[model samples]
Target: MLAQVRSIGSRNACLAAGELPGGPWAARGGRTYRTGASGSTSEAITRARAIRSVTSVRGYQEVGRADLFIQVIPFASPEDARGGLTELRGLPRTMPQSKGLSDVGELRTVAPPTIAGTTHVEAAEQAFLLDGEHSRTLTVWCVAGQTVVVAALGGRSEAIRWPQLAEIVEAQVAALG
Candidate 1:
C-alpha cells in the first residue's frame, strides 16, 4: 500500500518502514505498522475474522513530521455503507473523550472536496497545541461502491496546508482505482 501511495507522484517519497535513502529527512527514521483487529493478538484476529469485514489497516508516519493512516473495510451492501457513515458522523462528538483530550477547539463535519466525484463524510479538527507544537488531523470516510475507506492525516501545523492535504487525499482515492 505504501508503494502504491508513493507511486502516485513525483515527490521523493518512500515506504515509511523501509530503508532510508539519503535525503533531507533521511536522518529521521520513519515507520509504519498495522493496527486494529487485523493485526492484533490471536483472539482479536479470530473475532475480526468472525464478525468484521475490514480488509486492511495501515499506518504511516514520517518520524517527527507527518502521518497518514488508512483502513479499508468492505460492507455487504450500500445500506451497510450508509449505516457506517452514520456511525462515522458521531466521531466529532466522541473523539475528544476517546483521546482524553480536554481542549478540543473545533470538531465539525465538512464537505470533502474531491476531484473524483466520490461523495465523502469528512470531519476536521482545528489545529491544537500538542506537546507544545501545533497540530491538526482530518478524517475522511468515503464509500466507494461497497468499500468504506477511513483515511486520516495528521501533520505539524506548518508542514501541510489544507489544500495540500486535500490534494493528497484526492490522489490517494485515484490511486485506489
Candidate 2:
C-alpha cells in the first residue's frame, strides 16, 4: 500500500510515528515526522503495504527522549486512498496497542467521494495518553483504483504537531478532484 501510494503520486502525505513538538509538520510529503523507541516501524510499514499503488520513504531517528520514525507514503489517486481507508478502519478494533494507554474517542466514517474515480474514508482514535500527558492518532484513506494512501499520525501530545492537519486533508480532496 505504501509503495502503491508512492507510485500514484497524489499530494496527500502522512506523519511518521514518534515524538513531535506542537506545530505544523515539515513539507515532506505534506506530512509531519517523528519517532519513538517502542514504535513498530515494521508494522506501520507493513500496514502501509496493504494499500496498492503507493510509494514509501521511511526515516528513523532519536530526538528528545524518544525514538522517531517518519514515513512519507503517497498514493496514486483519491479513490485508492479511500479504499485504503476502508481497509484501515478495521485495524482500530483488531490491532493491539503498546499498553497502559486507553482509547479516548474515535471517529470512523466514510468521507465523501473525491474526483470521479476516487473515494475517502477517515477513522481516528485517541489510542492513548502517555502519563496523562498527550497522544492522539488520525488515519485517512485516499483511494483511486488499486492505489491507496494511509496516513497514520501517532506521538506524544506535544509531538503530534500539525494544526493544519484538517487543511492538508481538505487540500487532498481538492487535489483528488
Candidate 3:
C-alpha cells in the first residue's frame, strides 16, 4: 500500500520507504512521512509504530526550517481511513504545566477546502511564539476512499503558501487512486 503513495521522484529525496497499510502521512519524491495515526501530536508520534503507523515527508521546497511537511497513508478500509483522519484532527491543546512555564500555542480548525475527491477533511491552523520567532502551523487532513493524506507547514513562509496545503493533499489523494 505504501508503494501506491506519492513518490515525487526517486532521485535526490529522503525516502521513508516502507511496506504496509499505514496511518496518516505526507509524500514527497519517494519519501513517505508517517504522522500521528497521521495526527500531528507529540503524544501520538512519541508512542509506537502502530500509533505512528501513517507517514511523513519534508518539504519539496524551502518555504521555516523548511516549513512545509506532509503525510499520506492507506488503510485496509474507509473506516480505518476515517479513524486516521479523525486522529489527525485532534489538534494540540493546552496542557497543564509548572507554574513557571506556559504554552503559547493555539490550535483550532479552520474551514475545509472543497477538494474534489475527499470524503472528509479537517483543517487546523496553529500559531505560537517561542524564543521570539513567531511560527504558524497549517495542518490539513483529507480522507478519500480508503486513504488519508495530511499536509502541514509552518514558519514565516507558510502563510504565503498556506493555500497550497489543500492543493498538495488533493494531489496526494489523486495519486493514491
> Candidate 2, which ten residues in sequence have the lowest lDDT sum?
29-38
| Residue-wise C-alpha lDDT for candidate 2, range 26-108, written one tens digit per residue | 43333232211224344443444444323443333233322222233333344434543444455444333556666555554
TM-score for all models, in order of appearance: 0.58, 0.41, 0.58
Per lDDT, the best of the predicted structures is 3
How well is each residue in 103-157 modelled by candidate 1, as lDDT tens digits? 5457655766463534655656555566666677777777655445666666667
User: Taking the tens digit of each residue's C-alpha lDDT, what string does model 3 give over 1-177?
Assistant: 433332322222222322111222333353544434344444324432343344544444342243455555555457777875676566444423324333456677788777768988887776664445555667778878766677665554334355556655665566566
Better of 1 and 2 by TM-score: 1
lDDT of 2: 0.41
Candidates' RMSD to native: 8.4, 9.4, 9.0
> Model 2, residue 85: what's the lDDT?
48
lDDT of each: 0.50, 0.41, 0.53
